[model samples]
Target chain A: MNYGLRRVLPFFALILICGCAAKTMVVLVPDPDGKTGRISVSNQAGSVAIESPNQATTVSSGKPPTPPVAMEKETIAALFSEALSIQPKRPVHFILYFEKDTALTPDSLKQIADIIAAIRERASTDISVVGHTDSVGSREYNMNLSRNRAASVRDILVKQGVDANSITTTSHGKENPLVPTEDNVSEPRNRRVEVVVR
Target chain B: MKAITILVTVTILILGGSVACLAALDYVGIVKTIAGEVVIVRNAQTIKAEANTKLLKGDLVRTGPNGKVGLIFEDDTVVSMGSNSKIMIEQFLFQPAEKKLSFIARIFQGTASFLSGQLAKLAPNLVYIETPQATIGMRGTHLLVKVD
Candidate 1:
């Protein structure tokens, strides 16, 4: 070949080799009737998992567990690897505020209890209580009222078997109205505590 | 004469390059034809998906009424969407060595089973599913997500 042609040929050859080598996983299956059955496993889109058919072998004594087919092992490996990546390091927390309830009713209490139990079952995290109320009465009166509401919730949670230390209580009375409508009217929704777990 | 020869060679190269690029983007895992509705599955019953549209690879898919669609990703990862449920692929990549994948399926209303592959291990957070109330993150191995 001419000198110019020779230079281009190697570059083309290199590109082809790189392209072929980039594909690593190749799925291959065994022939149903082969002398020594061997299957190649790959992560390619069409790989199928094959299980060995059982044969009637009399077993009165202990027998060693048969090893899985190579393809099965490879497939399992791929799954495990993928699972490891998506696993969450820690459970996420959500905050829920009671909007339209002045006093904790039995149904509301039950719902709160259920939510706490659900959170506990799904994740292990601390729950915080931030209580608030709208502008009404005196500042001191509102603060005590908010604190009482928070404590009442905390006590109910404790009765439900949640550790007292796992809970933190704080009150924001007549200070932070979620809607901030500038009237001295008591908005039932604003007089509530938020449950947050993080 | 040399310029003419070079011109002809350049034209051929340009045409060949365009053809190769288009070919690469053409083959997708699953193509939704006729604009089918995605179902939200719950307790094996399929409901309409929140989003109504045709499905492509990585398209959020759920079972339709009384039907379950099983998906096996390019890397042999198996994810089953429950009836009356919701899910999104979020991200998926399947190359051998440099394989990296991220799938986020928001389960707004039901259950799902996730089985991971090698690429998923490389980037765990790449695959995230957001629901109406929570975001489920995958840990190593197998998991069944039930959003009730």
Candidate 2:
């Protein structure tokens, strides 16, 4: 009876070990926009870095992750299909330059229609229109000007039937410039309103 | 002296309450898609999730069997989970202007697809995806994780 019990104990131990094998898995894939990135998986034992697309690693108990191996597309799709299927569409960002102060440039003004279309398409839960200014004025002056710039964009969205509560406006006040310039320099590119719909 | 101490403590309490209220008003993420039974346990309150449900830091998301859900954080980070999944939004501090940024998420069980956002590009090392066994350090990338 003792010998039989020992054999059964070994069998249960084997099951435990196998159950712990690859119990946790991680795979690096390209970002939604197809941009490549890398991930380092680490445990108390050691770490392995994977940059290749579809590379995967299995974390085991009390051991460093196994070396990363490239996983098949089908395998990845099958395992992650549910999560993938529910993936949200990427946020859309738009930059509309200001002609002067708070006025939208002619080309940018014409883009209002397209911007509205994007907001509608996403059924955007929230929208942020941040205003920026070239360093052409006093900091306080630019701050107020930037606020107005952002408010103008928000007004347009609200006028177009977007919920006002869903839109937020911010002013960067020449603090974050697209084209870095010395104070009081009018950089056209730096004077812009950025809108992100998500 | 004791009265002054009590006054100071009361003032701190009031200030803390206001800060919490302000923080609650600022949502860090939104639920973009939900199918089946997905609920968010936030501050110990179970709120049924719907499309566009605002999510706050420290919220725990659990997906029932046959459930699936997706979220997009303020910085465009995306996370989608499958059925029988539990995820915690442990911490999120993004202030691009001040350069204060961190995003950490812990998954207790099930599968998830993660897509990094602005933080991934701005400061990848500050983002982390932690599981019961291992931790994933990212550098502007996407990841799929499963725990069974």
Candidate 3:
């Protein structure tokens, strides 16, 4: 649509559009997961929120951003081709379950090979292993237990030729659970280590 | 007793501030992709940017006429810009353990893309993008911004 306008107009028309473009413009696109999310654009005048994909809003003349309107795909590509071109691959996440205390379940033990393959495929230099536990034991005890669970995974990967420094292990304890359970409830899903390969 | 309590509080505050200063010395992000003449300005010094180069919190990335750069922050936030663009890495604090999460940047000019990362997923309202005429609060979405 914008290309049509430019094709019809001549030289001086370029300068007429705020000396080449609007003072500020924002275009919301679908997230990596293919889900459209909301975007809010605000200025000295007011705020306008848009939820549709490819919606664009521009704050011209400071009277708040005009109502967000759907933008053509070509317009987005023309404006952001370079930026979109250089985007790095999104990170991938892997979950490994544990049996009791610092020991990985049999299936999870086998999953380490898959995690390593992902690391090699992505040439990932940054990896984070976060451990979580079921809502059992004291918070302080669960925190320590979670750290040990994370260390168990980190140590195995380090022994398997992964860089120790590239991996950061943190203990989330029972604070974050896959399945929300009552205090002291034993949930196997909660005892897990999440590895994010980036 | 009151004076002693005040003295202890002041000492703790000073220690906390120094700890934060020490953390700032760590790299907040790394350049994932670089093409042409992308450069980063840190502490008034301009340095050529390359792939895998670490970006500090206060670094300002500026691109030449044909330059483009992509960066992934510690919390997994991604920022990419086209030629003739300037994006300031003003603030990035992602201490999830302590619940201290913030990501802020200012785009001085040109075209750029921003994708909210783990921090925004954790707390969307804390992420922000500042432009010359407007301030945008990012909410776990992707944005294409142009400042002319």
Per-candidate TM equals: 0.31, 0.87, 0.83
Q: Lowest lDDT 10-mer window, candidate 3 chain B?
A: B132-141
For model 2, what is the alpha-carbon lDDT of residue B137?
90
DockQ of 2: 0.54
**Per-residue lDDT of candidate 1, residues B79-148 (tens digit):** 5554555676555565332344555555555555555543456665555545443343443334444444
Model 3, residue B84: distance off in Å is 1.5
Question: What TM-score between 0 and 1 does chain B of candidate 2 receive?
Answer: 0.84
**Candidate 3 lDDT by residue in tens digits, B1-148:** 9999999999999999999986768888888888999999999999999987888989999999999989988888889999999999888999776788898899999899988788888878888888887778888678899899
Error of model 1, residue B142, in angstroms: 23
Q: DockQ for model 3?
A: 0.47
The per-prediction i-RMS, to one decimal, reads 20.2, 1.9, 2.0
The digit string of per-residue lDDT tens for model 2 on A32-138 reads 67877888999899999998898888887678887987676766787788999999888888999988877899999888888889888988858889999999989
What docking grade does candidate 3 earn? Answer: acceptable
Report, in order, each candidate's fnat: 0.00, 0.79, 0.69
Order the candidates by TM-score, highest first. 2, 3, 1
RMSD of 2: 8.3
Alpha carbon deviation, residue B39, candidate 1 (Å): 44
lDDT of candidate 3 over A1-198, digit per residue (tens): 597676545333323433555488888999788877666778789888878888877776466877887676766887799999998877778899999998899999999999999889877777889999999899999999999999999999999999998798989999889899999999999999999887
All candidates in order of DockQ, best leading: 2, 3, 1
Task: Indicate whether candidate 1 or candidate 2 has the larger TM-score.
Answer: 2
Using lDDT, give the best candidate's number.
2
Q: Which regions of candidate 1 are displaced past 4 Å?
A: A1-102, B1-148
